[model samples]
Target: MASQNRVDLDGNPIKPITICMIGAGGFIGSHLCEKLMAETPHKVLALDVYNDKIKHLLEPDSLPWADRIQFHRLNIKNDSRLESLVRMADLTINLAAICTPADYNTRPLDTIYSNFIDAIPVVKYCSGNNKRLIHFSTCEVYGKTIGSFLPKDSPLRQDPAYYVLSEDASPCIFGPIEKQRWSYACAKQLIERLIYAEGAENGMDFTIVRPFNWIGPRMDFIPGIDGPSEGVPRVLACFSNNLLRHEPLKLVDGGQSQRTFIYIKDAIEAVLLMIENPARANGHIFNVGNPNNEVTVKQLAEMMTKVYAKVSGEPLLETPTIDISSEEFYGVGYDDSDKRIPDMTIINKQLGWNPKTSLWDLLESTLTYQHRTYAEAVKQATSKPAAS
Candidate 1:
């Protein structure tokens, strides 16, 4: 394999390359577009179906490096448009997909067709053009790890020597394929396979990153089924909002399920690192997250309550208790595994990258943001008096 660290002769660092990022409208991609434009030598063409959320970043004088980025309101499912965007750049990062569990559960067929089927053409295009492909995968593919600590064993041969885990350390899968929740995992796993095969068969330069539960600003924050999924709002945002508002921090099943989180910025850094080096990263996979950032639902509620009380001048919200009797909330084939954490030795050893932020830092920032937004929303809603 070529040296993972490919340096130019002068060693002064090459100018940032050009990049086209698909799905740039979503939470992660939007942040990544800005980060790349400001920090890397690469200029960016950000393409997504025009959405207000992403358009917020495109406002004049909003993004410090806005000139370095060209925004395209194109859909990834459109092959011709996608092809044009892919061919114009040196690297293409695809983040478009039904990312949340609830969203995927509600629209499995659509998710499969759009993200899986639609992405194949882009993969093929990148292969033909010899442009590097950076595709997003999820830790959900691991299913569930049975143990408290991650097992040390790993089957991934291309992983950096220092990053490999033992046999028992890889992620675990639960129940069976019949469960609807597994559809997300199934799709993600299939994409990983496809990327691996494309790299081996067609000489496509591909990098796969499976990120754990990463939460921060811009995360979907509403509660209920129509709310985000894989437990997005329920886990972080809900707890934060309730705590801030002095409402109950509802818990399902005593909040026992455990998960690890990495800040969005750290996740973005790992993706960029992979895109920069194809020789070492091509056909390789890495888990991007902070191992130190594990927290259970019960623990999260408590933490949010504590943080809110400490930060806000108002009295902390009363912690309302909820019964764990609902089987639908935490039944078999519904939510699997009690804990999930990544063994970071691989990415750290190979790319010299590791998640830098703590979960508290992410949570605090999220809480502050939510408080501000919610406060504004309340002001707007209450400003108008009720009609007789």
Candidate 2:
């Protein structure tokens, strides 16, 4: 759906295409839906179990793009409507999965089933229907960096070759089965292999994306406000919850793990390129991340504390963070990924995409959203008297 207002790099009008966006109510999917509707003439068959995140786009038929977006409330695990939905669209995007890290160790069986087994039919339908598929994987599939195995004082740890993760070259290193933390990574790796094999033998047109900590607003939820009181969300939401409640952010294992985060909007531009130009995206596994924004978890905590204080007009707590062992924080059989920095060769060459937002700027914008969206709700939830 190329409009008069938008065109490809070659100055050609892009055709509008109907997209079957599975998991279309999650953080990434919601943003993608908004972008497509506001900018292009394309239509979306939005499928997901929950639609709260995207309700703003769905309600009030008076909205300009109301007809372009339709929501399907169903689960992929047992729904009979998934195949028909895929049949209706020219493209299918599989984003349905249990992606939280807290579930990896404690709920390994559900994790494996959600990440791997549940995705089998989605891949088969695409392969059988000859439809283009864009599947979302994770950076955890890269596991720990190569430098993690070297001695603590080794000089080669500074070399990028030893740590930077590449799509075609880096080995997928995982811990022992008993560690259990690798359950999510292992499941995701198997799904990637299956997708690659589908393209190899079945001539399926497919693309796999490995996201490295893409962050921004409407990500996950604030515990006890929009989500379960006992739920442990991804790091961004976890830290935001702590800030909103004026509680200390908890760090696991001294917060030594390092990661790079890209703004959700920046990453969405790459997806749009892929949607508009299948010639540049098919049969390739691209690493979508911002390597320039790398930081250790401890450094991230300090930065978040400062940014939250600045955004919320509140003083930082005397103890903004507390350190706990992984065993205590994540429970037994826990493990960690040492470092993750993506090699951007494939994505840059294919889509000409790059992440533009700096860490501080992105955090400021995100925390501002958090403060505005959850601060009052959290206060009300906390002020209530305890039930007997």
lDDT of each: 0.69, 0.93
- What TM-score goes with each of the models? 0.82, 0.98
Query: Residue 88 error for model 2, in Å?
Result: 0.4
Residue-wise lDDT of candidate 2 within 344-378, one digit each (tens)? 99998988888899999999999999999999999
Listing every candidate in turn, what is its Cα RMSD in Å to the true structure after a full C-alpha superposition?
Answer: 6.1, 1.2
Question: Which residue pairs in candidate 2 have backbone atoms (N, alpha carbon, C) closer than 3 angstroms, thus clashing?
Answer: 1-15, 1-16
The alpha-carbon lDDT assigned to residue 377 of candidate 2 equals 94
TM-score between model 1 and native: 0.82
Evaluate residue 217 in candidate 2 and report its C-alpha lDDT on the 0 to 100 scale. 96
Residue 16 displacement (Å), model 2: 0.4
Give me the runs in candidate 1 sitting further than 4 Å from their true place: 1-12, 61-64, 146-172, 221-234, 320-333, 379-388
Q: Residue-wise lDDT of candidate 1 within 252-297, one digit each (tens)?
A: 7677777777888888888767766665566778888887887887
Angstrom error at residue 125, model 2: 0.3
